[model samples]
Target: MQTHARRALATFAVAATTGVLAFAVPGAAQADAGPSTVRITEWMYKNEATAGEFVELTNVGAAPVDLTGWSYAASGGGPGQVPLSAFGEVGAGESVVITEAPAATFRSQWGLDADVKIVGGVTHNIGRADDVEVYDAAGTLVDQLAYNDQGTGTVKGPRTDGVSGEPKTAAALGANDASQWRLSVAGDDDHAWAATVGGASDVGSPGTSRFGDGRDPRASDGGDGGDPGSGAGIDPHWADVRINEVSSDNGDTPVGDAIELVNTGASDVSITGWLQIDSGAAASATPFAAKLPDGTATTTIPAHGYVYFSSTKGLGSGGDGVKLYLPDGPGGTAGTLVDQVSYTAGQAGTDEGTDFGAGAFARCPDGTGDFTSVAFKSFGASNATACESPVTDPGAGGGSTLNCQPEAPRAPAPCPPPRSLPRPGPAART
Candidate 1:
């Protein structure tokens, strides 16, 4: 449950303008985290015949990255701190694996594909409550991941072998949050699932990377962040962005259950790789955050611009909430939160016309005000002025705003209980 920044290259500093945490390095520049630029996406704890002790690296970034100058190291286990140099330039969305066991031995254990990249000479033994790291050419920390069997490490994982640590890789920063990982689902989270591939009985998909299609939420490119701008550090422009409005149930509505984002700043902000999470009883079962598609042309919101994300079933008529985050999730860590608003079932419904029968939750004065129930749906245009009745206490109606609150500190999502899965047999690589 704890992650240590092994190096002191950077320190935390709040952006005076936004009051958001920024890595205050002497010369921190624009750090762009793609998916998880060369991340230690998955690893297996050693158990005799159950699983192989190995570390998997993935280039979740937007572009290919060289691992030639990169290195892998393990701690809290057999190898003290022997940094092993890696080779190959991983293409975007590609995966390359390293292990101490024979490539064939590791493959047979996991039923991995022949084409899957594998390496031997992993002298380290993956263990319970162990730390594993991947560093860039400059030795900048790409990711230093730690996992424990009892859901006690930075990520809840493989208490037993064959069940590799399958952290969700969509959010970039979410990669590290225990809740965003698999294998710890049983008893840890409310749901459970498991898969056996390549004749391997492992409980996780070690080499597969799930993205946009609606799995995995962790993301990041490298040292700074992939929080779009927020993913790496605090964006001066983040303060001006707001969760303007939300519509629930009314899937029949043109926009279905939708969310609106507004930028109050003068200059446009790029939100590529940004993420949206719908947290509610219904959503909690399969909590998947939506990442903005890459490309400035489609991902940018002009100054004072308004953008709406529409869907069939994100909100629950009973009660649900929405949040916006920067894509800065580093391994075993969460992304920077931008805005969040939770609402009750009554406030989550279409207009019933009564005091509590309002149709949607909208900012009374538009983008910069508190959320009020309204009987209208403003897709991309301005909200209806007649819509009034701001919840005197946003929390009174089962609604709370993280970024909208006055002086509230920005929050990183706490690890959620993992979905359930029959743990893989305990045993690491040869």
Candidate 2:
């Protein structure tokens, strides 16, 4: 099956390059039932003043796509058709950027080295509204995307000069729908480029993976055949998955600190190639490269299912921050952040230094509620509704209390006793 898919893609690429290919617009009836492998993954109509606009294309098929005389056209705008000259080929699971800027300018601005196509004298007027179309050598319409200031299905408004537009995960088939499109998130490295380009603070991710939370074109639905660097094709949207609970202050014990995550979306989510960030001074500290639970490397969380991760890194009793990051590329850079939660020792009327010694903080409404103090530790279970009330511990000169609801008449199940701290060596004690 995989070999057949690659052959079909290679045939299509040849036809496209030779100008003999007859392709229909998406949704049109076709003799063949298979979907097109090459897709318009992303586009930036606007950019900094100095940088030229660009459209990114990705070959999701199993074979490389040849581009000899392809072109981009706008149905009802100036610079009607920008013809693409010989630009070599786009390999399987690889991306090629078509830009109005010279090759050098585009590379320097985006920090891209290769796989760039330059079309001089043709400027893309994607300002407020435009009908963008991709054509093969024979002028066959491969794909068409229309956007306006009024917006369409999932996209809220017109794509301004600085921001790029991308489709949502599982919504690639509905690209024209306004609601399916979203704005790109600028990375920390983009700040310098934004300054040089002289546009908004948000710079689009070009020649890279599609920005925002869209499906990874390079990823397989469940299999692992694509690039090793690309993450398992998981939806990178943080909203789909979240940190539901945290047992950060596990009574100063190394074994009790655990982090829980819940999938709130309708579909299953993969945590493959994802990382958990632990930042704070505590009994347990975050690991340098902690991978999620797929047994060996990666795993998936079924819809509405929960996955728990325990950390040896002692979380700060007073305050600590936890972050989840998606793997960006093979270089080990932190990709898009999936979700983050922070806790302060004394905020929200909770006891100051003593809260860490008391119990865990949980979210009300389970998967989608605000974090609050819980008297009972609900690891991998539903959270308690009532907040935990703090009491002073005179022996330790601090506060300590069993996990119990403040208003509940009866105490809930008590949390396991705190593990004893390791005794100091004889030499160290001396």
Candidate 3:
């Protein structure tokens, strides 16, 4: 979805991509996102009913923002666009709204299924729920929102006919807009993005956000709390793993490897009986990697020090498809597992383990599951390591350093059908 953030004097758009098509502008970073000198204070309803409610986009920027020929609509559904050319240029901090219908008739005309956005040439829509964002002029994002059917807030309507307190007040908007929002579940990315009090924003909340504890808005019932990172007691800890080297031709499995682990947590995590591997599964349904047997592995995680492990000679020759399993903890089932990186056999060098990229995975040659690089800034070393083992163990010590063969790319097979894990629906705002 698109998200826009307002700066002190500028606003930039956030770009997202799907497949080969890139949506929004490219290379726009938060830093590049200037400022929005203007801020949208609140939604103004023409009538007691919010059906006629219109968003006021104030230009707090230094220069005037052209609203000429601009169009606005509800995100979900409605008449295509509402022209704003008649409204003209919105001076810095000056408010302008393009409402196409009368107050009482608004809902009948451009109901809630619609989205309101700035449209000139390209089409961009705001997030459907709370803390959601839409791309601003510069493609930045504005967040921190409250949406419909909130557990902690009030809900507004199809349109409230009763005239109450100051309509634009944050409290009033929260009360009214809250119910108007649709309940939503946290996405797999563990995030939820939706509308706030203002239709001008594209900001959305995340699964971990205080607002992400409820149910899907579409659900007939109020809510059913599920979703990970919501309440499940998986303590958030940072673990660093490194890939020193890889080997080829080890018994049945052509690909064998070793990884280093470092516990960045305050407490020592016992990985004694644990195993590790990447995501994705092969035909046999076996996870591709593991931690070496307890004796063969490093047991205690010395706070910030490092631990190491080797795949159980089962990881195929290529890279990726790894996971971690701690088979001995009190609640030990399959321990937390993470994906490191995608490896290309022939393209990478031999023996010398490539450096994992930057970000969370930088410490390890294997990229973090998030796919952002964290370590191995070296040029060639940033690539994967290709090893070829003619015989099992040369008995060579030094942490199972295997002589890697250079180059060999594996062909991907057809992916199996989609299958759901034991996971449940995402968390809702509670």
Q: Pick the candidate with the highest lDDT.
A: 1
Q: What TM-score would each prediction reach against the true structure?
A: 0.37, 0.41, 0.32
The numbered model that scores best in TM-score is 2
For candidate 1, give the lDDT.
0.48
- Sorting all predicted structures by lDDT, with the top scorer first, yields 1, 2, 3
Name the runs in model 3 displaced over 4 angstroms: 1-205, 208-256, 282-298, 325-332, 335-339, 347-430
**lDDT value, candidate 3, whole model:** 0.28
For 1-430, candidate 3 gives per-residue lDDT tens digits of: 1231112001211211111111132332222223433333333221112223334344545587675534334331222234446546655434433332342233222222112232222223222122212234433432112232112234221111111011232232222233333211112121322121111111112112122122222112212211122223433232332332332223322122444454544665544444443323211122222333232334555454444444543333322333343232224433222212232221111212321221112223222211223222222132232211112211111111111111212111111111222211111111
Against the unseen true structure, what C-alpha lDDT does each candidate score? 0.48, 0.45, 0.28
Tens-place lDDT digits, model 2, residues 183-286: 44332121111212321122455554532122332213212112222344645433467776666654422124667677777787766656665542111212
Q: Which tens-of-lDDT digit does each residue in 246-266 have in candidate 1?
A: 888557454568777777779
Better of 1 and 3 by TM-score: 1
Two-way lDDT contest, 1 vs 3, winner: 1
Residue-level lDDT for 306 in candidate 2:
66
| lDDT for position 253 in model 1 | 54
The CA lDDT at 131 in model 2 is 51
Candidate 3: residue 200 Cα off by (Å): 36
